[model samples]
Structure formats: C-alpha cells, structure tokens
Target: MTNNLPLTVKRSIELLGLIGLIAVMVIARDIIMPILMAFFISIVLLPIYRFLRNRKVPETLSIVLPILLVAVFVALIVWFFSHQIGILVKDFPQIKENVKQHIDSLSDWISRITNFDDKQQKAFIQDKSDDIMNMATSLAGGAALTLSGVFVFIGLLPIYIYLMLFYKDILLRFVFMWFKADDHPKVKEAIYETESIIKSYLIGLLIQITYMTILLGGILLLIGIKHALLIGVIFAILNLIPYVGALIGNLIGVLLTLTSSQELWPVVTVLGVIALVQFLDNNILMPRIVGSKVKINALFAILGVFIGGSIAGVSGMFLALPIVAVLKIIFDRTTMFKQWGILFGDERPAKSPMSFAKFRRKRNVEVKPGSEKG
Candidate 1:
C-alpha cells in the first residue's frame, strides 16, 4: 500500500485538474456564448447564401440581399406598429382606467366568494396594485430599450453575416486546414451536419411562426378583436420562446380583451384560438419540422432554455436549441466526444427479440436449420 501511494497521488492530481478545467469553462461561458451564437446564426443563414450562389448571384450580392430583405421587413413592421404604439402611449390614462376597472370587477367577484367586504377587498388590491403597476411600467420601459437594442444589433448583424457568407469557403478551408490532410473528410462531415441542423431549425421555425400568426390573427379578427394583427404578430414572435410564450401571449390577450370589450365571448374566443394554435404547434408543426431535425428531449430542452436565459436572457433562450444541435453534431462526429453525443441524442438502443437462431443469423454464424445440439 505504501509503495502504491505515488500512483494514487497522481490520480488524485489528475481528477483535480479535470475539475479545474470544468470550472474555468463555466466561468468563461459568458465570453464564449455570444461568439457561439453568432456562429450558429451564420450557419442558419448559409443555405440562403447557397441558394443565391446556385442561381449565379455574386457572393457579395447574395449575402447583402438576404440581410437587406430582413432589414426591410423589420422596418416595415416597425413602421406599421409605430402608430399602434403611439396610440397606446398617448391613451395611457384611458388604458389605466380600463385596467383598474377590470381589476375592481375581479376583486369584487373574488371578495364575494372569500366573504371579504368591499372595503377590505379595495385595501388588498390597493396594496398590490402599486407593485403591479410599477412592474408593468418597468417592463414597458425595458421593452422599449430592448427594441432599440434589437435595431442596433440588427444593424451590426449584417456586417458579421456578410463576412461569414462571403468568406464561408475560406473559413471552411481554414477550419479543415487546422487538422491534418487525412482529417479533412471528418471535418467536412461535421460542417455539413452542423449546417444542415441549423438550416432545418431556422426554416422550420419561420414556417411555424408564419402559419400560427395567420391562423391566430384570422381567428381573432373573426371574433371582432380590436388589434387582431398586432396581437397575432406579438404572439407569433413570442411563440419562438417555447413553452412559456403561448401562456404569456394568452394572458396579454385576455387582459387586452377584458379591458377593450365588455363581451365575455370575445375573451373566450381569444383563449380558444390560442389553445388551438398551441395544440397545432405541439402536435403538428413541431413534429413535422423541428422535431425531426433538432431532436432534443423535453428535459434537456427546458434545461437549455434556462441556461440560455441565464447567460444571455431572451437571445440566449432563442439560440439554445440550435446551439445544442450543432454541438450534438460535432460531438457525434468525434471519437473523443461520442459519449456526449449519446447523452444529447434522442435515439434509443435497438432492441432485438430473444431467439438464439435469429441472433446467430444476425451474427452471420451459419448453423444447420434443424440442429438441436448445443
């Protein structure tokens, strides 16, 4: 035992080194996360670049066209929504009045059931209303700031995207050149898989958002909602956030409906429309598109969202799934990281039916068909 003490000490030192490396990675995550996000976004848009190139479009023009298209679309949306926002802001007092009235009505109903008098109910509400209003004000302020930040980011994004698109081949060569010539095939495979996953996810998300927006907007309009387009677009964008998005959108719709109209049917209709959209999203849209390519399970999907939210807020959450998918592709291609790939993969182990003859056949072991001897 005494003679083996040196080997034990060395093993302990190795274990400590591994833990230290992991700690460093965790600490440096914030610095690395943004670059990772940018890379993944570039990957997602690569197919558009390729499509243009295939059509004999110049590389520079191909890259610029998509970015310009996105910028123009965003500008149009902002221009359209600017009026609605102005109205909402200018009519703040009326909105507040409507909100307060709704709250009072709700409080009355609750107090009746709980046997609290009107005075006590008012007191309870008064204490909480200030906090709620403060929160709402803060959220609105933050959203304004966030919108401005988005425009800034969008302005800068094109530069990065253009560089990535224009120099994509050069970048690929550089990446593969980092390894030996013999390793180029594996590197190419990894790149292809990564690009495929990103493209599939982005396309699927775009299709899903568009369909949900149209469906929800049409339903809300039929139900006589005031701001059907505005609400539908809001829900469609928020739906990108995964599980919490639809619920948040519904809450907003319900509140807006309750305040804008006295009719209970419109509120019910809005709720029903959202429920139908969510059902379609989960059962039909996701399974057909996102589920096939980005095959992450629910537990890891939730974890990814949380991790992403912690690291970069909403942007991180939006990016978490694609980043994980890219990592899964890379890991699956590398022998050193295959176990990580397995952990992330949705594939189940193949199960074989119990049969000695069948097993022998599978193994290519020939045996007499009627032989009973062991």
Candidate 2:
C-alpha cells in the first residue's frame, strides 16, 4: 500500500525512521552499546573460534578461550598504563617546577610584548582559577561515573561475545529468514562482506596501534623526550578516531611534552616528530595495512564520529567507521537505499553529468565553435 506514496513522502518516512532509530540508540545506549561491541568483536575473533572448533574443541571451550585471551590482552594494556602513570606521578615535583618556569617565562614575554604586566596576568589567572577548579571537579565526577559504567560494560562484554559465537548459526538463520529465498544470495553476500570488513578493520587497527606505539615511542625516546612510551600509547589509542583523533593526539602529545620539560626545543622536537610519524601513518601505514575497499568520505565520517561520540562516548567514536561500512554494505544491497550507499562512499565520477566531456561522449562528436545553436 505504501509503495504508491509520493517520492517526497517516501523520503520523509525514511528520514523519520532514521531519527527514530537514533533516538532508540541514545535511549538504550547503556544496553545496546555492549551488544554492538560484542558483535564486532565476535567477528574479529571468528577465525580463532573456527580454528579451535576444527581442532575438536568444545563449543563452550572455543568461545571461552578466545574471550580469556582478549581479557588478558586488555589487562596487560591496563597494567602498562598504570605503570607509566605511576612513573609520571613520581616525577610530579619536577613537572611542577617545569610548569612554574614555563609560566614565568610566558608571563615575562606577554609583559614585554603587550601592556599587560605580570601583576595583571596573575590577577586574571586567580580570577579564572575558581571556575577552572569547578570544571575540573565536574569532569572528575563524570569520569568516576563513566568508570563504573565501563566496568559493567566490560563484565557483560565477554558473556555477549560467548553467546554470539555459540549461537552463530542461529543468528545466521535469523538473518536468512528476514529475506525471501530469491534474495538469500545477496543477503549472504552482505553478511560475508560485513564479516570480512569488520575482521580486517579490527585486526588492522591492532597492528596499527602496535606499530604506532613502537614508532612514535622509539623516535621520541631517541630524541630524549620524557614519558615517550606513555605519549606513544596515548596517541596510538586516540588516533583510532578518524580525523579528529590525530588532532587530539597532537594536542595531548604537546601538553605532555610541556609538562615534562622547561626547554622549548624539546616541545618543538616532540611536535616535529609526531608530525613526521603521523605523515607516515596516514600515507603509508594505514592504506597498506587497512585496505581502502570500504572507504568512507571525510564529510560523513566526521559527522559519524561526532554523532557516535555524542550518543555513546569514546566507544561510539571508535566504532563509527565500521558501523558506517556495515550500513553501506546493507544499503548497497537494498533497492530502496542504494542512493545512501553512494552518499557514504568515497568514489568520484570521472566527469560531471552536464560536463562538456560527458555531453560530447553522449553525442559521439565534439561541437566546433561555430556549431552552436543560435
């Protein structure tokens, strides 16, 4: 009955459905986020699960073993961060002294360049300090809340992954049942492509993180930057979030550098080194490791990152590209959503629809200057 609707009405309905879906996601984020995460993770671990099954491992054992391994990997990352943070804390007094020195120098420069003297600058800082303290307090409280939620999310993740793996066949059957027999082939193709994309993307990310850490950390250490490993690890992790991640990583790297040393050259060295590494990562490392088969255009990718972050915080940001890729797969396979698939893709047409080249090609002849219609 709805097939007879006007084109505008159909588009409006689609827009409304999209809004409804986003609303549902936001409302049930606490429950839905983990399930989505587990779904992607299960895809990443599917090969390991298959390997164990082929070796005659029990289904339960197969699932549990991979989850356990993932847990250990996560635990090791946490330990590394904790150890680095401990060392940072031990250097607190020196960092404080460095910060003081930098601030005095900055104040002196400002006083020399501008009419604002040191006393005025100190007074202005004092005036803003209370507001800064309040903001920090609120952020700390939010962090505490987020931490508890993270714990709950982590506890539920393994169980979700285990069930998804154990019941993979059932899930496959459900997906198949959603479409008619004639469409089963396309449906299967979409499923297979999604699995392949998720697996490759996630595994490539892991490899990217490892190499990024080593490259960034090693370069910084050789340059004698303090807390090089910590900076590397932080940047690698943050750099997971598409375009915005790199900028944030750079800012964090600079801040960390500033905290460690009073000398300006070390900070300059850190920035220059990060820029070089990022150049390598963007041009060489990522493209070669993570194939651009499912390339998302910059516009929607940034929008997805921000929307995901708003809805589900960091996890949303990290998952945005994969989610977009999966949706593109489904959209491309569906008749009603093919346009959306095109919108999400990075491909550019060789010529515009109304371009002279296209026009000449259509007419099978180029128009001479005097051949124009009056």
Candidate 3:
C-alpha cells in the first residue's frame, strides 16, 4: 500500500513515524531506561556468563556470580566516595574561608574596574546568594524524589540482566521471527556486531575511568590539591557524557581546586592537566581501545547527547553514542534507512559536489562556450 504512494508522502510518513517514536521514548523513559541500560550491561557481561556456562557451572550461579561481582565493585566505589567526602567535610571551615577570600578579591577587582562600590557589589551578591539558596532548597526536595527513583531503577537492573541472559535464546528467536529465513544471516551479523561493539565500548570506558582517576588524581595529589581523588572520580564519571562532559568536569575540577586552596596556581594547573589528558584520550586512547567500530560523526553525536538528555537525562546522555551506533548498524542493514546510516557515520566522500575540481570544471564549461561564441 505504501509503495502506491508518492515519494513525498512516503517520506512524510517516515518522518512522522520517527517523531512518534521519539514521543513514545520520552513518555516512557522511566520504564525503558533501566531495561535499555541492563541490556547493554548484559552484553558486556556475556563473556563471563558464557565462560562460566562453558565450565559446566549451574545456570543460576553463572548469572548470579557476575551480578555479585558487579554489586561488590559498585559497593567499593561508594565506599571510596563516602570516605573521600568525609575527609572533605572536615575541611569545611577552611574551604568557607577560601571561598570568602576569593569572593572578596573578585569584588575588589570589579570595583576597581567599574564605578560600583563594594557596598553595591555586596548587595548584588547578597541578592544572588538568596536566590541560589532558594534554588538549592528546591533542588534538595527534588533530589529526594530522584533518589527514590534511582533506587527502584537500580533494583530492577540485575533482574532484567538475569532474565535477558537466561532467556537469550528466546530473544534471538523473537528477533529472527521478525524477518524471513532468507535475512537471518544479516540479522545474525548485526547481532554479533552489536555485541562486539557494546563489549568493547563499555570495557573501554572502564579502562578509561581507571586510568583517568590514576592520572588526574595522582598528579593533583602530588601538587597538594585537597580531595584530589574525589575530583578525579567525579571527572572520570562525568566525562562519559561526550563533548559537554569534559567541560563540566573541568569546571568542577577548577572549583574543587579553588575551594581546597587559596592560591590560583592550582586552578590553572588543574585546567592544564585536564586539557592535556583530554587531548591524549581523544587522539590516542579512544582510537586504539574503543576503535572505529561505532564511527559516529560529531554532529550527530552531540545531537544525540542533547536529544537523549531531553528524553532521559544523564543516563541517556552517557548512552547516546552507543545507541546511535546501534541505530546506525540497523539502518545500514535495512533497505529503507541506509541514508540515515550514512548520515550518522563518520565516512567522508573522496570528492564532494562542491569540491575544487567540480568548481573548476563548471568554470571551464562556461569559458569553453564563450570562446566558441567569440
């Protein structure tokens, strides 16, 4: 029936379908997010699950063991953060004094540059501080609700992962049932590729986090930045959000540095180290470790981050790249969506339509006709 329609109408329908799909995702994000996150995590855990199964381990134990290991890993991280934060809390008076000193310095500089006196500046700051306190109060209320939702999400993840791994055969069959027998090979290929991509990407991220913490925290510690490990952990986790994450991480790093010390040199040092590490990570580490498997372009990657954040907040932002990569895989394999795959990809043509050669050829064509007329 759609084949009988005009091309424009067909395209319009596809666009509308895309919009509807996004709407559904946004509306049902809470239900979908945990399942989606668990699916990716299960893929990363597949090797361990398969290894245990191959060893003739009990089916139940195989699933439970990996999840136990993951839970223990998470517990260690929580312990580390709590310990670090407690130490930080001990320095609260000093940090408050440093902040006050920095604010006074800033206000004095502003007063020197502008006609506004210290009294006017203090009044302005007082007004803004009251607004900030009110905002923080509201955020505290919202944070309680968010915390409850997080617990529920976390509680469901292991169960979802267990079921996914246990009923993996049924899931494969369900997927295969969507297509004819003839297309089974391509479906199998996509499945294999997706598993490989997810495993590589997730494991690469773990490695990234470890080394980033060691590199950033170790250096900051040597330079005497208080709570250096805390800043490192915070940055490594936040840096998962692609382009925006690094910037936010840097900002946080600077703030931590400033709060910990009265000097400005540490803030500069933090920024410089972060910039250097980011350059190395972007150019060398990511390319070699994660590889070109996901090959998404920057434009779509940033757009995906924003769109995912709009739909599902931080988790969505972190998951955006892999999600786009998976979508690109499906789109490339399908007949109707190959163009979208190309759009998401990082591949560049040898020569664009607007290249110098094409421009020169058009000029030659015009000149040739004019020469003949003359």
Instruction: Kindly list the per-residue Cα lDDT of model 3 for residues 6-97, writing each as its tens digit.
Output: 97998898899999989989999999999999999999999999999999999999999999988999999999999999998999999999
Which structure among the candidates has the greatest lDDT? 2
Model 1 misplaced regions, further than 4 Å: 1-37, 51-58, 83-98, 132-152, 350-374
Per-candidate TM-scores read 0.77, 0.93, 0.93
What does candidate 1's lDDT look like per residue over 1-374, in tens digits? 32355756855765687578546646775545545555666776676777998999987888888878767876887886797667557767766777777777888798778988888887877889899999998899889987886666655666777777777779878898788888788888888777777877877887877888789988888868867777787888788876666677888888777766655787888888888888887877767776475466557777877777776677777887887788777767765456556556555333333544453221223424432111
Q: What is the lDDT of residue 305 in candidate 1?
A: 76
Every model's Cα RMSD, please?
Answer: 8.0, 5.8, 6.9
Per-residue lDDT for 43 in model 2? 95
**Per-residue lDDT for 252-342 in model 2, tens only?**
9998999999888987898898899888988788888877667787899999999999999999999999999999999888867777886
Give the TM-score (vs. native) of candidate 2.
Answer: 0.93
What is the model-wide C-alpha lDDT for candidate 3? 0.88
